[model samples]
Target: MPGLSPRPEAAAFLRRWREALIGACVAVLGLYWVIFSFGLMIWIGWAVAAAGVVLGVAGIQRARFRAGSDGPGVVRVLEGRIAYMGPLDGGTADLETLRALRLDPTGLPAHWILDRPDQPPLAIPVTAQGADALFDAFASLPGMRTEHMLRSLNAPGGASVIVWRAADPAQKRLH
Candidate 1:
């Protein structure tokens, strides 16, 4: 049993890629079905393969959103809030109330700035513990452009970029 356990670095690597690897395996199985199945089954296989491809693409983006958990804070996404407990600073941002999201790349490890209407912004390092959960959190935002967020997160150091902004309160009231 001990021998079967992966080494620390290997475990870390796998942890970072586990979803993508699972997606790859699913896609392969679907492809195999497409190759050897009967007529109706062949149609089913195509559907399965299509679903697998979508899962695989999402997994790849999630993997890209993951930064190592070696940074200075621990992030917790609970209910509808994201809380960051850092060495020198800490705060919480309610998803329902988040007004804007920004990427500040001036620090050694970049930070995600979560803005809420009445509170100071919560600055969470991209590499903080449990930061990967942010992918789902950010995705839940209406009209969030995920690819742009991923690109900005991985870009070279520069000025802050606003990744998302909540719709105007007046517009929401009209709806």
Candidate 2:
């Protein structure tokens, strides 16, 4: 034991490529099954391969999200409700009651503006403590794309973005 020093090379390697490793493993397993098996096995392989590709793409997005900076407030989500408490402003929005979701980064601070019927809009900074969770919350909306939201979130400031909009025409659109 005195002459041996523990090596973390394997751990380091995995830490860097964990998602890609999983994706490759899934893809290889799927290909192996499809090539070596038949009938139902091939269908199963296709499922695995599809999942592998989806996971690989998600991994890349996740990496980009991890690079996002922590913004200027605390964001809390509960039972389809969201609340933002910041130094300059704070408000709450119910996901169930949400009529529209817009992003305005052109301002001094980027904001996720939630619009609800008969209620004032609520704006939460993009860098809020729990903003990352909004990625999933926003996705729950009909036809919301997590990847698109993430991309818009990381885009350079200057223009606003519409992350989600209800089918109801009453929903507001911020130009």
Candidate 3:
């Protein structure tokens, strides 16, 4: 009942995805109209536009369902452990409260890797403008310990990783 709410990050992702879908739909509609007026290849253009609209709607519906699902984000924390959700290939991971912080400077688009044994490392893409805020957030975690540096994956500029040890293991477990 509790672990089933939408997180702020997820909401933001949905918002951006919606905007992109709308833009794509508009473009597809314009193309459909142009092709219709030309009187050549009208059917093909209509099909393509229809497919685009269907796919866009499906994606939005999927995101909405995910946002409403009963999952890890629904829980409330008072004075126990704190867990942050991160995307995994198959499911999701509840990152440790705060263990260690590592910053790497090798990847081009730059990324922050948060390390924790309880969950897989969270690799967050970073921009120059967001680096300071990200660092501050990590530093502000309730109980963080060791930090480390890792190798980059051939990105252009550089990258960084941050590790934190969670204070409450119970609350940090992945749902």
Candidate 4:
């Protein structure tokens, strides 16, 4: 007898969609409660189902944001700052001070150009270790469209695209 195992593609799909799968399960459970229960439980079930849908959508976005960790760097996001440690170069950028975000797909692995006023742009490879953290960081930017960012990320193009920009480029102060 031989042990059963998932194929490579199936395993990868599972790994990428693990959070979404959990969210779907939660939604199913909530729907079940909504169908079988009554009174306050039904309202609670509706809330639960809504929350699960939100989670599932976010999980899908996150899964799409993740490329791989085979690039030549490591990314770290802490306290509203993004730091990249690459083999040849590295830099840190404060999220609050960023002026614009661009995706340069001309490169082999592609690089995210984090631009700040009066400073050298920090370029982090999309496939760098922990690069997925950029999803949350970029999401925090006011007026950023997650769908646009995701589309630009996976789009086949040779030119760089601006994903986000500060409403008032001169206004660097948070307050």
Using TM-score, give the best candidate's number: 1
Per-candidate Cα lDDT values, in order, are 0.90, 0.77, 0.46, 0.90
lDDT tens string, model 3, 1-175?
9789899887767664773477477558857676656665666567666677777765543333222232222221223332333233222233334455554446433445556567676544443222322433543466643132112222234434344445555767576
User: Number of clashes in model 3?
Assistant: 29
Q: What's the candidate order when arranged by decreasing lDDT?
A: 4, 1, 2, 3
Clashing pairs in 1: none
Query: What would the per-residue lDDT of candidate 1 be over residues 61-165, giving only the tens digit for each residue?
Result: 998999899999999999978989999999888898999999999987999998888778889999999999999999999889999999998888999999999
Residue 8 of model 3, lDDT score? 88
* Residue 96 lDDT in candidate 4: 88
For residues 81-105, could you state the per-residue lDDT of candidate 2 as single tens digits?
Answer: 8888988878888888787889898
- Write the residue-wise lDDT of candidate 4 on 1-175 in tens digits: 4888879789878877877887888888889889999999998998888888988988899888888777989999998999999999999999988989999999879999999889889999999999988999999998999999999998987799999988885766778
Off by over 4 Å in 4: 1-6, 169-175
Indicate the residue-level lDDT of 75 in model 2: 86
